[model samples]
Target: MKLLLDFFPIVLFFVAFKLWGIYVATGVAIAATVAQIAWLRYSTGKVEPMQWLSLGIIVVFGGATILAHDETFIKWKPTVLYWLMGGALAIGLLGFRKNLLKSVMGAQLELPETAWRAMTWSWVLFFAVMGVLNLWVAFHFDTATWVNFKLFGGLGLMAVFVIGQALYLGRYVKDGKEVPVEKP
Candidate 1:
């Protein structure tokens, strides 16, 4: 349910793009993202940092795309978001005593420090790699192809990441307990 909610803006963006144009689609996406965030907050009384960051990126890049009359601005949106996340994770690993993944997922994941460290590092690296890949695809691919990749490819990568993470998490997760997520 939450996953579907998260994808609502992307779906809207795609539909709007098909109906109107890149700029209008981006604008609509930004609006949808904000509405979703507000709805989530009202219903749950909390929001994730990632969600807010994503919203910010959509608005910023979407506006840039509209203002500059170039899709390139929006194209780099993912790259910026992913790289920032990657850098934050990497920095957290280096600076903090406990792994960020462990802190967030420790409720269900009881893996050792080494495992947590590795997982955290993997996230950092993955996001960084995603950023680079987004840039490559945007700059090299055709406009339609880039849009498709931005929407479908990004979602595909996310699906793979979640599945992979579930596998890894299952290895050390306690027998039958749900993980606790921080919402702030």
Candidate 2:
């Protein structure tokens, strides 16, 4: 499924870290991301911009970690990517007066303009907080703790955030017939 495909790289990175170490994990992560992109391209006939950005960040930070024999670069990668996403969304909203979330999902979900802006800002704030939290864990804890946080804590928080978003947005559905899209 799409969720499994989306998480493949992170899962591989966790496994590799547990078996080997950060250096080996970094290599595995890079390879897995590359493979993910390739699979997406082959199946969808195109790669999303976010995927390209992730690949670029991993290669740059992971490559630096390998070449310099420093784990700091790899530790910074997640925070960098998170901040970039938040920044992009913020800029789209404030600079261009656009709600990117609405633009992307508007076809599927109809909602009022206020609800659209609220959702976009919610994601922006989430990304910002996540970025800061990643940095905090990366610096305050040891490698093992950081890796655990990255794999478990990060994913858990994301799942919760997404579920919360869906629930909140459901209240403002323009169709006036709210229904759960996924089976419980």
Candidate 3:
């Protein structure tokens, strides 16, 4: 359910792009993102920081795409978002000595400092690579192909990365319990 909610705007955008075109799809994406945020705020009494960032990016880039009659702004949106997230994680880990990934997921999973650091760094690299990938696709392909890649290829890569992360973390689990890491 949460996953579907997260992809709501993208799914709508893809459908709109197929049915209409880029400008119409951009409008649909903007409206869908705004609606998603409003629904989340109304239902949960708050929205996550990432969700708010997504809303801001969509509104700015999608608005530009529509108003200026250029699809380039929309095409760059994903790269900007990914880079921003990666930068935030990198800054939190390097500059502040805080693992933002652990801070968020700590309540759900018990892991050693080493594991947390590895996970955080992996995410940082993933986002950085994803940002570059988005740009590569956006520039190298046609608008329709980029739109297809945005929905399918982007999501496919994310799913694969997540599965790989889970497999990597699987080693830390033993007999239904988290294995404790020994201190050096």
Candidate 4:
């Protein structure tokens, strides 16, 4: 349910790209993202910060793509978003001594403070790497390839990361209960 909602914009963008081209695809993406936010707000009465950020980026970058008649701006959107998220997480960890990931998922998954910190750092690193990866692909590959990478590569990497995180935290899942424990 939530996963489908999350992918709605990307899927629409992919389809639009196949049928039309980057400009039309960008426009479709913008619309899909806006619709996603609207639907989420209507259904849940609240929009997540990430969703809002994504919406803003798509609107600005996609709009620029359309208005400027250039695809570079749209291509940089994912990298920018990724870097921003990583930056925010880094600030929370280093500046405030807070694990943002734990703050978000703590209610569902309990782990030792050390584990939480490790997970937070892992995510920070992951986002940073993904940002770089996006830019690398964008610059090296053609627009069509970059678009495919955006939908498939980005999502694939994220799925792998989440799966790896789940496996890493499996040890802490205590008989179907979430119990935070420190490693001695």
By lDDT, rank the candidates, best first.
3, 4, 2, 1
Model 2 regions lying over 4 Å from their true place: 174-184
Q: In order, what lDDT does every prediction score?
A: 0.85, 0.91, 0.95, 0.92
- TM-score, cand. 2 vs. native: 0.93
Per-residue C-alpha lDDT of model 2 across residues 46-154, encoded as one tens digit per residue: 9879889999999999999999989999999999999999898899999999888877887887777777788888988999999999999999999999999999999
Q: Is candidate 1 or candidate 2 better by TM-score?
A: 2
What is the alpha-carbon lDDT for the whole of candidate 2? Answer: 0.91
| Model 4: residues with Cα > 4 Å off, grouped in runs | 179-184
Q: Residue by residue across 10-110, what tens digits does model 4's lDDT show?
A: 99999999999999999999999999999999999999899999999999999999999999999999999999999998999899988888889888776
Against the hidden reference, what TM-scores do the models get?
0.88, 0.93, 0.97, 0.95
Model 1 clash pairs are: none
- Per TM-score, the best of the predicted structures is 3
Error of 3 at 108 (Å): 0.8
Task: Please estimate how well model 3 matches the true structure, expressed as its whole-model Cα lDDT.
Answer: 0.95
Write the residue-wise lDDT of candidate 3 on 32-151 in tens digits: 999999999998898999999999999999999999999999999999999999999999999999999988998988888988999989999999999999999999999999999999
Error of 3 at 76 (Å): 0.3
Task: Please tell me which predicted candidate would have the highest lDDT against the true structure.
Answer: 3
Winner by TM-score between candidate 3 and candidate 1 = 3
